[model samples]
Target: MSRDSLSPRSRLVHDALRDAGIPGEIVTLPDAAATAALAAAALGVEVGAIANSLVFWSDGGPLLVMTSGAHRVDTAALAERLGRTSIVRASAEQVREATGQVIGGVAPTGHPAPLPTVVDEALAEFAEIWAAGGTPHTVFPLTFDDLVRLTDGQVAAVD
Candidate 1:
């Protein structure tokens, strides 16, 4: 799709990726990819290859976690590793306030600012991974290493 055809949020994500020198094409889907299953189906990829961007509340700030769709995030273990008392799921308001995007559509990059981000180490198993493009109906593909580099995310066992 042309750059002008993208939604504002998706455009931001596209621009951010370009500015970061990451090469990928942002694809617009005919349907919403609100869930990993949906996104996987739409992209004809395994669910495990989908990177689910999630926001959490930790140390009174927003934490972004890009986890594999195959497993749930182990918040307790992750929190302990981060030396935090706890990490709870952020609310819709908190997510928007932090990422400037709503749930089901948060991208690793293009947030209001650089958020403390953690990427599931399991995602490295996939040669190519798909992530939301700041919208439920848009997505982009990238290598696991590129994902880590673009987000400047810490590689951790989130699940």
Candidate 2:
């Protein structure tokens, strides 16, 4: 059972996870889980095991980047690799508009459309990882392969 409350967006994320054939149960945090570090502590996992779903504005509009909590993304380097002019952090409104989820709770899979995604290779080090479930206080555990399959993201060294 989840310790935190479930939101409409979180439910959508749950459904998406199920539909993607990823076996994970929604977990509710007692307090806010707006950061991967906080979620790692709550879930009793290494910081690197948390998959932080971040949104960026690139040449192609909204881009989803699911990164490892232990590393900071080098947006410029990533943009260069993608042949993008730049990669800027998206605003809260832009995040909501693109993902239909708020800033802190955006899931890697439950977006409004199929967002081009970049997955941090660092996350591949962990066999199991946790990510936000479209709500600040909810999360779900999944394997790296499952995450890649669910999001259809490209694995790269974004940091």
Candidate 3:
């Protein structure tokens, strides 16, 4: 679907991407890609090629971890590496408050404010990766470098 036809949140992501100098167009999936596996199946790509936007509550702040779909985040390991005492999953309300988007559609960017972001180093293995576009049914392709730049993120091992 065209950008004009995108949902409000998806359109916000589209505009944010454009402003960020990303040339990739947002693609609306026929079904909701609420999880990495679903998105991968719909896009016909390896699940690892999907960037999962995971929001965590750490030290009273929100941290966005753009992890690979292949594995779950090792919270303790990640916390230790980041010098954080804890990094627990955010609740649905917290996710929405921090990202201004729902859990399944939280993009790396386009939140109400810029969040401290971490890009999964494992994702660099893929030449191209897809990320949620502010909604579960929308997504866009981007390079690993594009993710780093778009989110102004620090690269780290998420699992």
Candidate with top lDDT is 3
lDDT for 12 in candidate 2 is 80
Given candidate 3, what's the lDDT at residue 99?
91
Give a tens-digit lDDT track for model 3, residues 1-159. 688898999888898999989989899999999999999999999999999999999999999999999979999999999999899999999999999999999999889999999899999999999999999898999999999999999999988
lDDT of 2 by residue, 1-159 (tens): 542345778878887888988879888889878998899888999999999999999985999999999989999999988888999999998999999988888899777788998989899899899999888888899999888899899989988
- Residue 98 in candidate 2, Cα distance off native in Å: 0.6
Clashing pairs in 2: 2-28, 4-28
Scored against the true structure, residue 81 in model 2 reaches a CA lDDT of: 84
Instruction: Give the alpha-carbon lDDT of every model.
Output: 0.93, 0.88, 0.94
Total clashing pairs for each candidate: 0, 2, 0
Q: TM-score of each candidate?
A: 0.98, 0.95, 0.98
Higher-scoring candidate on TM-score, 2 or 3 = 3
